[model samples]
Target: MRTVGLALVLASLMAGNAMAQPKWAIVVHGGAGVIARAHLTPEQEAAYRAAMTRVIQAGGEVLAGGGSALDAIETAIGLLEDDPLFNSGRGAVFTAEGRNELDASIMDGATLKAGAVAGVTRTRHPISLARAVMEKSPHVMLMGAGADTFSHETGLEQVEPAYFYTERRWRSLEQFLTQNNLPIPARPEGAAAPDAAAGLAHDEGKYGTVGVVALDQAGHVAAGTSTGGTTGKRWGRVGDSPIIGAGNYASDASCAVSATGTGEYFIRLTVAREVCALVEHRGLSLQAAADEVIQQKLTALGGDGGVIAVAPDGQMAWSYNTSGMYRARLADGEPLSVGIYKDEP
Candidate 1:
């Protein structure tokens, strides 16, 4: 009788240990817009896919190693900010005045603390600055020259405005101004002449922003977003990227969300928070909640954009209204998956 009782106790303990195992996952997006398969050459698609693959692996390593969701998301988003393929830091699109003005935000789900920066021109990685704002400053957001000054004081990397120049984005800026019949701003100081080989891929209304939502082994979730705002924006135009609850939100009780799309529409709808609200308030699954806000609500409002999300349970999802969205996801002990077009499974 004594032996039987001891065996039962051991069995119960083993079951509890198994249930306590952590589940981690991460999802990312480069942008969403009118990216039709017919428009992207095979080479272009491959380039984008390779970039997303690299980002997912780098971020996934952090979660797999038991890092906090906040660290994992910051690592992932900082890489995207460095990569020119997406519009966050380097290779960012230019304003109407031909200057690069960047925006970024980060949210920690475990504590609900958030940080953001807007119109930062000299900071090399705006995402890091955003995190600094959350960790170092008393404010939720800092913008324009004050944000730049804070960045300088924080000792974040700074660069000459010319460092952001790239032939691809410059050509897009030129083409955009030409089509809209706006006066062309002179080439920025220290920027090189535009290359004739640069491709023409300009769509200010549709594509451009980089974001990440990560759920770590500790069951914490976090979200981040970064962008150069819309092309040819004038008079200090800021976008949803740096706006908490608009382009980025995170909550361990529900989910973490990062969005990319037209700034005005996202701001109008509070897209990121809306997705999380559906899950917390309406008892929707991660996928269903994302679809409900992006596919139905945003679409009905005539907005075009997309969102990537991860819940504390490690459920991951992405939804978009555009023809394509540059996205990728990875779950604990699962293969990395990437999707670009609307038709992908």
Candidate 2:
């Protein structure tokens, strides 16, 4: 009888501890591409690592402080959008016409609410505009000049079209256009003369979009994706980053997903929603779902890139087919981790 009583007490204590533990997890990705070690100088590699570390630490603080998953993901993605190293807001890649157009999407798992903006030219932070559309408007997406106009009416910070330029990205645009045998437009009016950013491989690790997926203490999941579209893309082209279910998806019933890669392929496969569908309908683990979609399905389609996900049960996973993907993660009570190469654990 004493043994049984002791077992019961211990069981109760275990349950109490479990209830007290907070469950929050977050994952971030800068981009995915043919990033080989030999291509980058040591200084270039260090820059990416330090930037990813800083972004994850900021996200961790939000989740640890009991902030919503939506807030955490938006905060993280916004920072990535601002960083010139990744291809989002500042230093975004240029279109064939020598202009930068941004796209972004955000979703709330608990409510299945989502918002997106495409071809937005003036907004400083496209992720925030996406969230504002979700909470403040009745629509799911806005596009082009209309989106920029809406941003102005909504009182979001706007920037001169020239603010997105960087010499590195400009060089990338010129290279892509030259290699493709396409007409290369003269550098935009605001761009300074190019410098020696040419030694680094332009298409190495920064080929896709920036994304964040998070599961908060409230058991809600959220995701956001932002990008400047592809280098040397058509003047009005839009990518998967701003399209929910294509590049971004969230649902409490399954998981939140943010994808980066060939936009047309992601859109055709509905990659983001497919991950959640596999989790909800096939009982797959978060990692397994991400692998199935990114590895098997996307690979069969001859596509490149990857995805990051967070489940309601605190699982966080990332999968990519490229040689390297700039990524980081942090969970409550767990140490933060950041990685770049496929060889990394």
Candidate 3:
């Protein structure tokens, strides 16, 4: 009898240990948009797929090998930001006035603490500044010049305005302005606007790009998003990126969400938080809630785009109304991806 009891106890302990084994996961996006078959060349599609593959692999390896969730999120986003194809860090889009204004936010779901920076120029890593704000500052968000000041106080590297200039972004801006027939602004001082023949400003109505979500690791969750603010935006437009539970929201009790698409519709719906709340309070599955919000609510509100989410039980979902979204997910140890564009898929 004594031997049997000891054996039973040992079996229970081993089972517990097996269940307690740590698991790691991550999801990412390039940018969501009306990605039509006609728009992508074979080369561009291949490039996006390759880029997403590299970044997701980098982040997944870190998580699979016992990395922190924070590290995973930052590492994944950093890669996307560096890629000019996405609209975040280095490859961010151009504003109406033809300048780069970036916004980013990060949240730890376990602690419910967050940091964000808006309209930051000259900061090498806006997400790092956001982390600094969450960890070091009294505020949840800092914007414009104040954000710059905070970056300086924290010893973050600052760059000249020219550092962000790239032919692609300039060309995109010019194409957008020309397509919309918006009045062209006088060149800054002696500078001349890029030639109109370059298809500049062709896609101006399509500008909002952000990403966020949580991972399935035990007792951990996080949400983050980054973007180049709306193109041709006037009056210092600030979107939901820096707003808690708007552009990004996370909770260990429910899920984490990152939104992309039209910023106004996201703000109108309180899109990120609403999804989490529906799951937490209304008992909706992560997929159902996301569908309702992205498909139903935002659509009814006259907005288009999508969101990425992860529930506590490791359930993952991507919901969108656009032609394509730049997204990838690792679930149950399988690499799954969803995208409209050929390269990102």
Candidate 4:
């Protein structure tokens, strides 16, 4: 009788510990573009990988501490936005007019609520502003000066347009102008030219966005995405990043998805929602749905890029049609995985 009681007590303790352990997962992507190992120097590759790892770990800490999925994803994307290495906020690409424009979106799976901002030039963290729109305003989307004004009203951080000025991004604009044979616009008298070597690789010029999808301990999922839009974009172009169904989608019944790539194709296909539909309606697994949407549907339309998706069951999937994607993942009881090239573990 005594032995049996001791065994039962031990079993109960084990169960308690298991239940207390965190059971969430997170996946993030810097961007998906024509990233070939041969084209990237060793230093550039290492830098990208390090940045991704840092972002994922930062997000993981939130989940481990019992934060909501929405909080984790927003925190992760905020870091990326602050880093000048990725093309979301601080590192945003230059428009045809030599200015930086940014966009971002965030969605809550539990409530099916979302917020987005587009074509904003001065808001520092667009992802946070997107969340503010979802939580504070009655509107689902805001644009241009309106979004900036809301950001101010909401007391979110704001910066001058020049605060986004990075020499690397400036050089990218120069390269684009040179390649297109467009006349290089003269800089203001006191403005400085960017270092010639500061620009990203030529092929990486397009498709630079950052996103995250996460599943928390309570089984809620959330997704968020941010972007500087495509390089040399003109006429106030907004990419899929700020579009809810295209670049970001979340649902407790299925999965949360955040995408990067050609905004037009994503918008036309509603890529993120399409992936969720395949899971909700067709009963497809998260991996199957993401693969089909990224590899087949988007490819058929001449679109390229990838997505990070997390299911309600703590399963995560990342799929891309490009040669490489800057991605990282962290799941309960699994080793952290970060990769920039296709063949990496």
**Which lDDT values do the candidates have, in the order given?**
0.88, 0.88, 0.74, 0.88
Candidate 2 is scored at a TM of 0.93
**Tens digit of per-residue lDDT, candidate 3, span 1-345:** 999999999999999866654365567776677776677666666666677778877777767767666777777777766666666666566777877788999988888899999999878778778888999988899999999999998998787654555556666677778888866654334224333213211232356564645464554878888887666566678887777787888888888888888887788889999999999999999999999999999999898878888776677788888877767777535655645553443
Q: TM-score for every candidate vs. truth?
A: 0.91, 0.93, 0.85, 0.90
lDDT of model number 4: 0.88
Q: Rank the candidates by lDDT, best first.
A: 4, 1, 2, 3
Model 2 poorest 10 in a row by lDDT: 193-202
1 or 2, which is superior by TM-score? Answer: 2
lDDT of 4 by residue, 1-345 (tens): 999999999999999877654399999999998888898988788778888899999999999889999999889999999888888887788888887889999999999999999988879999999999999999999999999999999999998887677777776788888899876665423336353235443346477899999988888999999999987888899889999999999999999999999899999999999999999999999999999999999999999888989988777899999988899999877789998888875
lDDT of 4 at 63: 91
Ranking of predictions according to TM-score = 2, 1, 4, 3
lDDT by residue for model 2 over 3-64, one digit each (tens)? 99999999999998886544999999989888878767888888888888999889889998
Count of backbone clashes, every candidate in sequence: 0, 0, 14, 0
Clashing pairs in 2: none
